[model samples]
Target chain A: MFLSFCDGNGSALGWAVLITVVLGVAGCAKNYVVLLPNDDGTTGKVAVAGREGVTLLEKGREGAAIGGPAGKTFMVSDEQIAEDFGAALAASPQKPVSYLLYFKAGTDVLTPESQADLPEILAEIQRRPAPDISVIGHTDTMGDAAENARLGLVRARSTAETISQLGGSIISPDRISIESHGEKNLRVSTPDNTDEPRNRRVEVTVR
Target chain B: MLAMRLLVLAGAFSLVVNVSSAEDAVIGYVKTVDGDAVVLVAGKATQAEPGTPLQRGNVLKTGKPGSMGVTLKDNTVMSLGPDTELVVDEYLYSPSDGDLKLGASMRRGSLNYISGVIAKLKPEGVSLKTPAGNIGIRGTHFLVTVEAKD
Candidate 1:
């Protein structure tokens, strides 16, 4: 049975050993985690800290048993993943999309290009079910911190207002949250009193 | 004298209310649901639907055939499968102040998690606690399943 588990891969022997050990201790309910690839096809790492030690999972579909010793990992079959996470996977919502709408210097007015992109932002919100939006405004570092904060809020409020007006019945006023990051969060890093166009913008995220 | 005392008591009560309201700002919202999903707030269960607000310390649960999806303010996405019970133990997402944390505990069932700005900015701050062990997120996607203990 252990030999049958090996698929002639370089790591087959190690996997067979792990599978044998896993089967030997199958009394308790199985608890585990699987590393999956991101939507963009990039893989990241997860560190599972068990009672014994930590196990780092770096490959897609790679899994490790919870509450067990570290260094014990095996590839989770697609069927097993389907059976275990089918509902959670199915319940996954559409990924949120973000838009950076640049503003005119020291003003709440949107740049011409950003104004043209408003419709696309509206379409993204309308595409989702029960969509909610967050408009976070930022300002360049050319003014006083407190004043920039107020300016950021003004920009955010204006953008949110425009979005609500364009969305009309599709968007509820309560679902839109507006905040200001001010000079504290600049898109382009610059010294104090330096003007940067990219830093003066409103970020809209539709979820 | 009694009226003055009552007025002072009311003043104190309003202060407490304001503090709590500011502290418990909405951290996320339910974006999708199928069948019987509920969010437990202040020990009371409310049927969850799209646009339902989520606060820290709330419990998200699903029935035998239920499932739910939520998106946090930082764009972190999470979905729960049937018979799942997840608690948002802590959440702090003030990027300007350099405060970013996301922590949750899963008692049972499955969860699909996608990293967001919190994990991207401070990977050490994101964690998912399970009955058996804890998982540290590092700006990626993963799935976890914790079977009920016998």
Candidate 2:
């Protein structure tokens, strides 16, 4: 890293002082980060300066590195990053959340694991102050498109019923939204009539 | 010695009050908190509560076994998972005038981001800086994780 910054034009005193400060700062980790555009070709730039040199982050680069003219520079990509950005400022939310649940073959019943997972899902719903649940059911390719679509709705209703049972009055009719995507949106890609267990499922999003 | 420490703390407290008055503005609120979380403002760590207003330059920290969720004014939803630090640097949103920008830094842990009105209005306006590099958003949802440092 120090090699990148050494242009061979600095006095000995300047280099010594820079090295000292760099070592002092590097004793603890402080990363600097800058976000770059993703695969769509949009772009952003990140640069770092050390005691001896500066490095402009090349596109598609990511890390927590140290070394430059100042030797205190560390740069990394958004793929994996952590860094302090600035001085303290006074600051200060409710955010929505979503989840998915999957189903069994040729039936509106939730798969065994999903059935077992019901209590936790119900708990999450109850935790939210005003939860709005959106449940969508889907089926694998084992039947006609129309039948599968109807089956999807059946599955969704079944799940809603379970939620109502678990939550009692807390899970209200008005707050529950049910929809179906029977065979239309397969969790697993397969030919017609394929019994992909993964495709038979329901998605529950709570906000 | 104890009295001296208290005096120092009082000075710091007054300094924080002065700084907050100049630049703090609510841009979001904590919707949920699991385990332990705090809002670091003007170098002070205050236990974060649901509905705590988030302001510019506030660093958010979540302890082990802790997580926090927030919703920005523009509806951007962000969730931080155990052992994370995030700082909001700059944010501006004005749909009518086509003005929108968000700048933040993440130090560690995981962050789940769901784009809001600002990103939908202008994708180029949002950016997150990390030690590894910057993340440019082009999608409505993104889940990013940064492992704990030694």
Note the DockQ of each predicted structure: 0.79, 0.05
lDDT tens string, model 2, B1-150? 999999999999999998776457567767677778899888999998765767888899988777788777666778787778999798886553566888888878667666666776777788777765566554354444544466
lDDT, candidate 1, B20-77, per-residue tens: 8855899989999999999999999999999899999999999999999999999999
Candidate 2 stretches with Cα past 4 Å from truth are A1-207, B1-22, B148-150
Model 2, A1-207: lDDT tens per residue?
332222222444466457647875343333332333433564434344333554444444332232323323233333233332111101112344555677768898776788888888788877865455667888899979999989999999999988998889776776676788788877779999998888888888665
lDDT of 1 at B59: 95
List the lowest-lDDT window of 10 residues for candidate 2 chain B.
B138-147
Docking class of 1: medium
Instruction: Give per-residue CA lDDT, model 1, range A96-117, as digits (tens).
Output: 8999999999999999999999
Off-target runs (Cα >4 Å) in candidate 1 are A1-28, B1-19
Which candidate comes out best when scored by lDDT?
A: 1
Interface RMSD of each: 1.0, 10.5
What C-alpha lDDT, on a 0 to 100 scale, does residue B51 get in candidate 1?
Answer: 87
| Global lDDT of each candidate | 0.89, 0.65
Give TM per candidate: 0.88, 0.41
